[model samples]
Target chain A: MSTQLTTLLAVFLFPGGLFALVLGLSLKGLDRRVAARLQGRIGPPLAQPFFDLVKLGFKRTMVPATASQPVFLGAPLVGVVSMLVAVALVPVSGLYSPDPMLGNLIVLLYLLMVPAIVLMIAGSASTSPYGALGFSREMTLMLAYEAPIVLAVLAVALRTGMGQGGVITFSLTDIIAYQRSHGMFLLDPVMWPALAAFALFFPANLGIIPFDIPEAETEVLEGPLLEYSGPALGLFKVMSALKAVVVLSLGIALFMPLPFDGIWGLVGWLVQLAVLMEIGVTVVRLSMGRMRIDQAFGFFLKWPLLLAIASVVTVTIVA
Target chain B: MTDHTVACSYKIPVGPLHVALEEPMYFRVAVKGETIETVELNAGHVHRGVEYLATKRTLLQNMILTERICSLCSNSHPEALAMAAETIGAVEVPERAQYLRVIAGEVKRVASHLFNVGILAHLVGYEALFMHAMQVREVAQDLKEAVYGNRMDLGAHCLGGTRCDMDDEAITYMRSALDKLEPDVRELEKTYRTNGSILRRTRGIGILSHADAIACGVVGPVARASGIQYDVRTAAPYHVYDRLPVNVPVLDGCDVWSRAMIRLSEAVNSIEILRVCLDQLPEGPINDGGDPYIPPGQAIARTEAPRGELVYYLKTNDNPEPERLKWRVPSYPNWDALTFMLKEAKVADIAIIVNSIDPCISCTER
Candidate 1:
């Protein structure tokens, strides 16, 4: 409505949106590097993911004759939009709109599911056997990992506790501010284990190695992406990379405990966040082999799940 | 006579251009509601008429030809053919060459398992673990480079035995590499076995009954996973596998999970084999022969490739070039099991299960 509002929206929506897109895609590149290093080879550069996205974006799109057109076109866009929403929530700089709470932890959590749900619908819409197959995997993965992720987030929420300023807010900014003031990661005794829990669960969230069954290229070509191509495919590729960044940012926001409010601190924190995410992913990827689908479920169901529950209960008891 | 009846059958053409398995293959699945009635495999996707080309190249030139057969099992193809050449001419290989051949074969085995298991993990949605496994596997790739002098086409194998020998420094470097991979491999094995979601999807998904496995002529881990217990390494040990004892892990489940577990266990066994070979460090020349080209005759050589029993049949007339060369890759037999495996496998398991066999399409088609 106002020129000032328009300028502010441009900063967050344009640069912030582009930053999320670029950084998110950068995660994919980071993932490639980390994966390569872990596998004992020199992996691709940080720019490798961008190249892949451009390559996939420019490639011709093929759709099965029997598939529904809307679902095919809509799936990848949903992936991009949801990630964009997630990025908008991340406190990149001190600048904030009237309702910064829109990017809060709870909203981010709810939004995270949109891309995956969209993918499931797309997979179901496509008549291809691989699409249907990938759809089943995506559903199964959501069911298995969603609880652990929620539990991990809850653990972070517990560690930060509630501020004395007002009614307890689940806003990410509030959580970061609380940590920044009280030596962040230093609050909850269970923070280290919670961070570890995030480490184990994050790969599944990003669909990087060890948790990339839904789009197993060797087996299913590209999973939910079986039939997508051109711009639509690029969006999915970009969204995945973006999702990687969002997950890493969430990890940093809750765990890194750095003061990202200052300009220089924000840049330093972002770089550190990027490097940490890349190193975490790379070390894990190259060091291990894949788990079977059932085995992956088993892993989530076991120690990670238990730790999540334990962290929540511990926080509750301590409070 | 049994009537050839298309009774209540539907044709589901898979591949030559589709997902679930790489290297173009088409399976016309005739099914009666998930019960597969018959399977017709069309395998001409990657058939480059390599057998025809064998006549045009000299024995030495064919070495590179054999390597290109399968990008994954590049070393195994040429190694088997070279072994056949040695047998045809009754050539005596140097002791050092024998050790080197065993080293190369075992190292490739480790690397191939890493590659396959990584794919299996990737297919199942464990991207991080897949990358980790492959990253650790790079140690084997590095070792391949250090010992054989190349990563993919090691150029190590020859008619007599091998073209490469390890010096003390190189042997020490290789020993350290094995040492580095041991812990990582152990950690991966622990994670895969305990990881619940992985077990859920893979366990009992593709139950290849022992009877089905035998009838299908399944080789390598596919058969072994089904309780067939037929590892060419133990049954007919070649290239020093006879001297060393290897406990073949056989699980009766015969599903995708079992095959995957079998690969993991074999990877462990391969590391042990490499360690032992490196420690032994026998002394001799790299080769003990005249020209490696064999005299006129037909010879069949067999070796335990990463996938399974890879056999190479070579027919050499007096010409410097062989008349014909046929590489019987393990995937050929294993791919046939797909029709049976895919029957009622909830479509999602199709790709992951197919990848568990580590099908080398290039080698099979070549």
Candidate 2:
């Protein structure tokens, strides 16, 4: 196949479009089921997310009269597209790797930001009070978490780049390859702070219970998505599922992608992803309550920011 | 409407129908960047004209009508209405009937308070704790269903005394249910008291000062949470509450957490009260045999409901129906306190603060 055809196939077929959507929706279903079990209730089935998507598809997409029609309708499409491409960008260890020319870690970071940006745009464009409130909240959360993530990514880049006789490298493949050759970065004490920083970023970026202030169902009635219904809402769901796979897979690729190739690599990757989802998402959401926006803002600034800075400073010294 | 400054560009209407509120009470909140500058509460969506309905219905019929006024505080309405009518008619409630009334009130108190705290957890996004609290409340609900034959609207009170009489088997079932409820409630209380997520959201979020609490004349847990020592069961000494070991827990925190803790303590206290009611239940008649005649007169009676002090006034005429029937629910006073609580409060805290009052729209509007 030509390079462009292979890239298209990669984006639309394998690790990106259809496969990531299925994987992401199933993970969400599992998260809900496990959360229900943890709370001592019979939760929905594993196919519940898919069922919800189908239900959403059958319903009409109602747009508010006051909302900016194009912007409001367009945001979810942009979000879904970005996530599909992002899933392709993230190489799943030995099972598949993307063509480096498609873009690198820097491009992936920008794509990773599209969902939050889409939310902000969707919120603002909807012209509802709660949506505007959500826009500001998403903006604030993005600002708060953005700093640590940049520093953490830079820390990893520095650690890997210096190992390969370069000052810096924006390539995720090189980082994965470097980690593969010299053992996993997760085991190294130098990368632990960045890992911790990344760990904290997950809940906020994913908009889970503690940092879900922007879209608190009780307070804002889903904030940005309050005015959204039908297929538009389903698109947001699709974006999230793809984003979860991308983010969790990004976490693995960044710190702890196992060194097994072929089917074993895919199995190890699946197990690791499930473990991360179960421990990181389900258990944490079940255990903790939501934080007020100001408190969450302060928490990200004080702890994650400090940890990221420490990781960068240490990576500079150690590498 | 005592005082609040509304200074913001956009006014948000948080409904007669919203996710946070159990009942329909619209709040017109003005915000200055996610911080609420003022809140204008518009009530009466649940205005079923129960007060007017009460006057039209016969005294015997009003017992059933009044219970439908509010689901959570259902027992209190008829209990207070019955007390006022009994006082007006110069009818003394039988000793066994009074004990049964205490048992009914205490059981409703436990269920209602658990519900309020459970919702608080839900608003904080701690759904696990919310579900667990609800599961604990389910035990109380089962106790109500087994003993009173309804999950809500327990029609236990009559004009002269109690309508529902518990047999020995029902009493034994209640003891075991109460046993299952107590430890679960204790564990829930500990979580709310110490859990980081709950504390972070609620500890000092909604400040209803002790001075503000007194000025608002807030009753029930809202009053007790703000350090005001008032419980109608203890202060007014109605219906064997004086004889029973009723301890009112007071806190000076004057916040959402304090309100929740106050409710939990009351729920715990209610279990003890229920136990005592069962143990010392007299073996005489449960009522005056049948509905006693209520002669022409006027009287007022107060009772400490699960929320706070619930007041009812009654005036009887020659007709079968009363000439007038009115009430002052605890939520009425506690509702105004939200204006103070929402002042400069973060928008996210609005629902939590509103819920902290445990405001019942049905009773307030009726």
Candidate 3:
């Protein structure tokens, strides 16, 4: 209701959402550029993603005969909107988000899950066998990565609370405020392990490799995205890119809180945030190969899950 | 969630057309409880009758045709065809030509391996690795262009010798390029070996034992990954390989990961071989052999391609064109092994594992 909240919401919705969408695509382009250099060939242009989106956007979209229309139609829209909501919740270049409470740790986590759910619903709606196969794989991936992600969130929450003289706070603003008073990077050293856990989670949560089994190109053909075309696929891609921004931003927000507290101080904070996200993604991706769905699941069940559990314990201990 | 739905098993199909690998293939998988019961591969979608088309094209023309088989394994086809032609012609190519051939071939091997590494990254959704791999490969491309004047089809080989000559400037360029690549390839190899995600995904999945590889008739990296020490370069001694000291990496795992590792190791080895060839290269004419002949009898020649052993069978009838040419590319044997590789691997590995063979579907179908 306040003008500040309204302004913050506007910034998050347009710039934050757009920044993520564009940044994610740019990440893909940068990936191509890096790959080209490695192969000893000059690869496609850095704006290749922009061109691809334009091409896919103009392509035809035909629903399969066996598809369920509502789920099919609603899935991509929901994917985009949910990502938009996540963007809305995360403070990008500002002090707080619009309806800042929605930026509560739990709500942000739930919003992150919505895109995957919508993807499954849409994938199932297509009724294509590949779609079904991809959807199932996506579900497995969802289960695999979710625990680590939740634990990552819990680690940040507990670290913030423990560092703030034993006050437990779930609010992003509160976490930021705590960090503003007491430097964020100086939270519980146990939070270092938790941060490490989150670092791993960022890739899986965004479905990047070594954890991208569900959408393995050879096996699933974009997984839940096999049947999507034209604007629908475009929207899905945009949402994915935005989701990258959101997840990375969320990671940045949790551990590397802003040095500046005021809204005007956000420019420097956002730049630092972008660089951190880029470096994190670049390092992890370059260093790892992809995991098979089963292997990925096995991994989640073993180490990442343990890490997550450890974080929760760390939260309890630190809190 | 229904018992009835769970009780009855159904068939699901995925792609003869999709964006996993650049090539398209179909699969009909039967799943009974989220576990795949059976997987049936449907190839031939991308088959453009390359073999049948080979029957129509002349031997010299087919060199270009063969290079088009796959973007990654671009140099293997021309090398095989040229070797086959040499066997039929009974011509001993100049030593310098032999050295040049080996250098060019090894350069391509490094480039091809890097490309496969990128695809492996792409498959696992490791965009960063994919990009880095490709970036490193570009140095090889530059060398290719500098040496042969074309990145993809170097147009180097005729029957007895190559079309392009490597001058001092080109040699200098190659030296500098390898210097840049040495560190990059090492770092990339380390990442593959140590990264938990990649190591987890590739280490044990799609394991093909030594027996399975021999039974399936796998060749090249696929066979080597299963601990087979059969490299055509060392075993058969093609070109200058008999003269040069080459170490073929043999991993005993026989799994998808091993195959990937073998390629990485080979890339480094190829770089070493190139440096040796460069140091020892004798100064002579690139192509001093007389004009190529269309022999009356058939001749079989084999070379160690980047993938593995590539066998070329040529039947010339004393005409400008060859009567018949049959190429036993590494992929023909490797593709047969795919049935075994994919049998146990979770479906997600199909792309990378298929890519690990560097499956030149164009070469296979051709």
Per-residue CA lDDT of candidate 2, range A1-319, in tens? 8989888987988898898899999999999999999999999999999999999999999999999999999999999999989999999888888898899999999999999999999998998999989998999999999999999999999999999999998888888889899999999998999999999999999999888888999989899999999999999999999999999999999999899999999999999999999988999888888988888899999999999999999999997
Clashes of each: 59, 1, 29
Local accuracy by lDDT, each model: 0.74, 0.91, 0.75
Candidate with maximal TM-score: 2
B103: Cα error in model 2, Å? 0.7
Please identify model 3 stretches exceeding 4 Å from their true place. A1-60, A79-109, A144-203, A209-213, A216-219, A237-262, A265-276, A279-287, A298-319, B1-4, B7-15, B31-36, B46-89, B279-295
DockQ-wise, the better of 2 and 3 is 2
Ten-residue stretch with the least lDDT total in model 2 chain A: A92-101
DockQ of predictions, in order shown: 0.21, 0.90, 0.48
Model 2: how far residue A315 lies from native, Å: 1.4
Candidate 3 — number of clashing residue pairs? 29
Residue B93, candidate 2: C-alpha displacement in angstroms? 1.4
Which candidate, 1 or 2, would have the higher DockQ against the true structure? Answer: 2
Candidate order (lDDT): 2, 3, 1
Q: Candidate 1, residues B178-256: lDDT per residue as tens digits?
A: 9899888888788778886578668888788999999999999899898988888789887777777577889898888
Q: Looking at candidate 2, what is the lDDT of residue B242?
A: 79
